[model samples]
Target: MASRAPGEPDYQRLAFRYEPMAGRGERRPVIVVGAGPVGLAAAIDLARQGVPVLLIDDDDKLSQGSRAICFAKRTLEIFDRLGCGQRMVEKGVTWNRGKVFVRDEEVYAFDLLPEGGHRRPAFVNLQQYYVEGFLLDCALALPAIDIRWRHRLTGISQDENGVTIEVETPEGTQSLACDWLIAADGARSATRKALGLVSSGRTFRDRFLIADVRMEADFPAERWFWFDPPFHPNRSVLLHQQPDQVWRVDFQLGWEADPIEEQKPEKVMPRLRALLGEAAEFELEWVSVYTFSCLRLDRFRHGRVLFAGDSAHGVSPFGARGANSGIQDAENLAWKLGLVVKGLAPETLLDSYDAERVEAADENILASTRSTDFITPKSEASRDFRDAALDLARDCPFARRLVNSGRLSVPSTYRTSPLTTADRDAFAGPLEPGAPVPDAPIRIGGREGWFLDEVGGAFTLIVFAGQGALPDTDALRPDPLPLDRIVVTPPGQDGDPPLHARAVEDREGLLARRFDAAPGTVYLLRPDQHVCARWRSFDAAAVAAALQRAAGGEIGRC
Candidate 1:
């Protein structure tokens, strides 16, 4: 264990405990490698679904420094489902507005969450160590998870049925087997290396210095980005406020900058003074120089071994997509893997994980590549284009869309996913099939609550209704996979709660508006809270068919 440091998280080393099963040649259902935010999230989500998991990590303590600080809304919502969202939110700085500046002059700004009625904020800035600690605590509370620290996976081989792995622990090297293996060991993944897999993509030729400074300043909790600032002419700079009076400052150090020299306090302090003025008081808590690449494997799944998080894909940190997308990967995979492990769905269902997440990775890669290009243009023409966009953004609203100070992270919509059932009726909003279910305020049994909290972690049929009679959902329930139903009626409507399904009131009319629901709108949500199918009205047969499709049963539908 490490001693606590002032203005820093105490990095406590976890004692290595040898697993006796390694001596017995016993096999576990799921084994997750690397206990970072992604691996821990995967383990906790799997455990919540009654899937036993053996989580192993090479490091004994939490990662040093605030590696990933800007957590997006969708990631926080997933954390909320994992039982630690509130803790992260309370301990982190929350913000939605982001301002763009060009040469020390203020340009247009944007609000990530322009509208209200969402349960969580658009983004929360928290240190990665705090996130890992919270997720670690959640995993520790679950009996189904056995987390082993200081367990390094040195070798791996997978066949049609399972995967065999060799792990080097503090005691000795041992062989272990698992029915399924999730490789989340990060960008320099040992698991990916053992498999002889390749992650091909372009690596940007630029570096940035991240300085986490502890200061008692009254900066607003918003994202501030400057392009070609006066202090650092022809370079970019970003500012973000974090909890505990720590402000994250990123200075664009081009390819010519020496990373070793740039990280020293003498070099870093001058840059800070240039931005914060000479009289500003602050202490550097952590500092590092990093270059990023947008890359991902050709596929996320190989036989019974699945790759997740950075092991599966990676994006530049500009948009905070690395950890956010990794966490999304964990959420997207856990439910499908859970069903497959439980024999509720065929092993083929896991293929959808590959299809959907690959698309997501591609989307993130595209966005990240664009942001990197705009931020650090390789050619003079590209830099001119970016500058023009930023300059015109002040007067023209259309030009504002061209500026890319990191699109920020948003949940992916698996529109082409094999499991999605195309809408048979016209929809008026963004709640399309394969879209994540939007969260909204609601009232349940006269108590205020969130719409998503009432219906997730299972296959649910949500029917938006009015004061009219509720639809009968008795015939909608399927065997072996009972479909839970919820009736969300408009507020101030006189009605008795339905006996067959849980009922909630759309207190602010946000639910109905967000989902584009009318008196009889119906939506079938998967266990992961993504819409598989929807209709203008409740159709039991349609709901059942969509349910089957979502559960890996084709039912002769696309």
Candidate 2:
């Protein structure tokens, strides 16, 4: 493989081996379409779970521009599980503070990671190309994943048991079959179109021009959003620093503005010059005009075919919801698909993917819609309200709460998910069922590590055994899917080692505080690391029932 140039990606064409498929009619267990971040993430995750994945993409190159630059902490953790988080964090620019401006006056500023002691930062700004490259490398390194570039999904059809897809390769067209299909084919999804699926939602009239420029500057690594700035009169603008001396600038253009003309060098140069001033020398790397919509499919799961990422739902970029949510969708779906493929869980478990992710999509759409509405008010009354909020936010702290300059991406809690085993006992903290496991510093045999790192990517039963012996494995489920058990003891417990091999000491009492842990509290965590159930005391029958419920089985609650 050839190395990529400074700003250009090397488009390496991968070999297609459909001839062998023709000789032996074999249906792969999983087929992931599209090679973008979401598709790559799903493929990598499935491969990690010991599932063989066939990843197909229409293109052989990375994304052209710095698209979807903001990556949330949760997404980074998912990347960490996928084996590429360290590289992304090292190569991306980390920013937690964001300053909102009304004209030239700074009104309000906020910090995403207000508290300390986190493994990952609040967010990172890396170009979409870099993300895809890292994900592609991770996928290639995994033996279970076979990536076929230039393999376009031209047709798709599914029945009760499997899906048959037609691919258009450089050589010719070929047909392939799969027991499961994951459509991560992006916003203009060819697979979605072939399946005759259409997304329904509101498309905003507002437009935005994104310009990626390369320049040596001393701008702080922070998000700067201007509402009616003097540089660009009435429209809103956003600026952020990226890696490699590159910067992203977004200019809000009204509905009537011509996108083609706005993208021209003549039109873009003046705006860039006004923003950066005449003395600043900068080279334009990429420019594009875009209009976003908050749209989603009626259902993410259709029989044997499933949709993930932009193929299932899309939100405006203001909140960084686009790629971040897509990556999460991949993570959420991967574990369920893995369990189903292994026959450890019922097929009905897959239905929870749609039920939970649709709720998440609605949330992202709502947040993005509100941000768009605030940034570009459609009515005079709305503009008056927005201006009032901004004006008062300059002085009063209460008014700052009203300002919504894109509610930066955060993982959605699947509170109402069917997979969640409802909490029957009273709990004090936020480590509830369906919520992602909170990260905390823990001491394991004199070494420090994150709590999430120890309990993720498997069905884990975390026993807060404060000076108590760990629960015996014989008491738990006899033999289901592999369940990892970790015993977290209180600080300075000199008790004998527990039954489980993995044990940690909550030296700072962070886990105790975050989880409201008692001497015998137990938490049942899903493979994706979301809390499925918790109890004040360990009950083998309850834990077994919850595990069955988490895996889409009918059972009585304790």
Candidate 3:
């Protein structure tokens, strides 16, 4: 076993023994299995909030492959919170177009840019390996996190005080205790299986041949697909560009494969040539065959064990929603877990994690299922319908619009969520309270324009047009919690809004309408862009009480 340097990010050669904490380091708050995106995300979040986390994974090195490439704007917003969005944007390609071909002929093309006044929806195609490395680097740098590789979770048992995890390491077997455990060990999750969680979803009849290649081709930098795929001799093919000139190529295995014929790259290349014609000169970086399946665990949390990422939900990689959804899983669960570990909210608050995340994971499954269904449809009739739709889309811009947008990933509005407002007319329509606040760019003090997300962190109190005095956030504010920067839009007026809540110069609803505010309405937005609470206008007492309740406390004390 090896150990990482004090500040060196990569810890591949390092391992830490689980010494039973008896004195200073006896009880840990959480133990997370799997060092993938979701696991690392959870660890970082807990560490940020001063919780101790021990992360375990079997893999020693980051998995290399352009597995999941596309990241939605919501995912970017999440990275923004963690201070990584700028680097991601700088390192990835923000795609806005896609092309579809039928029988080697261009059939349809679509623009993905947001229409109307919607915020620009851009997706990045970065190799999953790089992303993990970046996140791992960030996570391990924190003093409260310890990531252990070559550790496979074999058994887990929990009691009243905490949970115990049995791991098989190179040296020997060991047990670690913690307040809770997160199972992010992928679809064939050992942890989920141990808890007897049921996951059910259909496997597609056809298989897909995936080839990650470094290609310098004439094709534009976009998601390129060939319909009526000759490679499959039935379905179609897709190509996604990655950061380093690598492309993820997928072709449906239309015909029953002869094990002998399927093994040869020559066979696959010939078929690819038939489709690409002159453009087939592109080089193949790596290739493998993967089966497409859609599955979701019956539960996202079980006792002290919670599942995120593929362990909670599995989707075909066609739409690349899998990892993005998992990252979101971390964002939601992390905050709640932070509060629970801190004793702000009851452990029962963990139940809502399953409820809300299960809904979002279902959304991801449906979207990826649809994308898979469209690309490698089950029935011949369905395949024909898909082709015809693409052809028609080429002729009609309206038809192309939907295909192009890929339905742009929108945040799930937890309308029925226990964490949401049940008041019927409390919040505005078109957007939900617990959903990602639509990007409304309002100029700050008449100088520059920034979107709603740029309004800074912490709870945002959105005061509608011409409202009243600032709520007595101090009254309800929890002890050690800061609410001093509360921004009030005012009782009525058209002026610039302050950058931070506490910096207003006595006038402006600048950021309120940026979030689509209405007069006589007050909006409270959470750090993850969800609505926490709201009112008609700012009332010192009532608002303070609600804020107190929202803070899970009285006048002061978290």
Top of the candidates by TM-score: 1
lDDT of 2 at 334: 96
TM-scores of the candidates in the order shown: 0.95, 0.95, 0.83
Q: Candidate 2: which pairs clash?
A: none
Best by lDDT: 1
lDDT of 1: 0.88
lDDT per residue for candidate 3 within 1-558, as digits (tens), equals 122224644323333354323332356788889988888888887787788898889757775555777887777777766656666777677787777766666657667664434333567777776677767768868989877777888888988778888878777777778899989888789997777677899887776777776655555678787766555555667887776666677777754755456647896677667655755556766667777678988888778888999988888876667888888888788877887788866776677788889988788778777776667667888777666677777677665543421334556776666666544355445665566676544444544343543543444566554544444444444345434344534423343444434423222343454445555566666656676666665555655554444444421232
> Judged by lDDT against the true structure, how good is candidate 3?
0.67
Q: All candidates' lDDT scores?
A: 0.88, 0.87, 0.67
Backbone clashes counted, model 3: 10
Worst 10 residues of 3 by lDDT: 502-511
Clashes within 3 Å, all models in order: 0, 0, 10
Candidate 2, backbone clash total: 0
lDDT of 1 by residue, 464-484 (tens): 886466678776668888567
lDDT, residue 531, candidate 2: 92
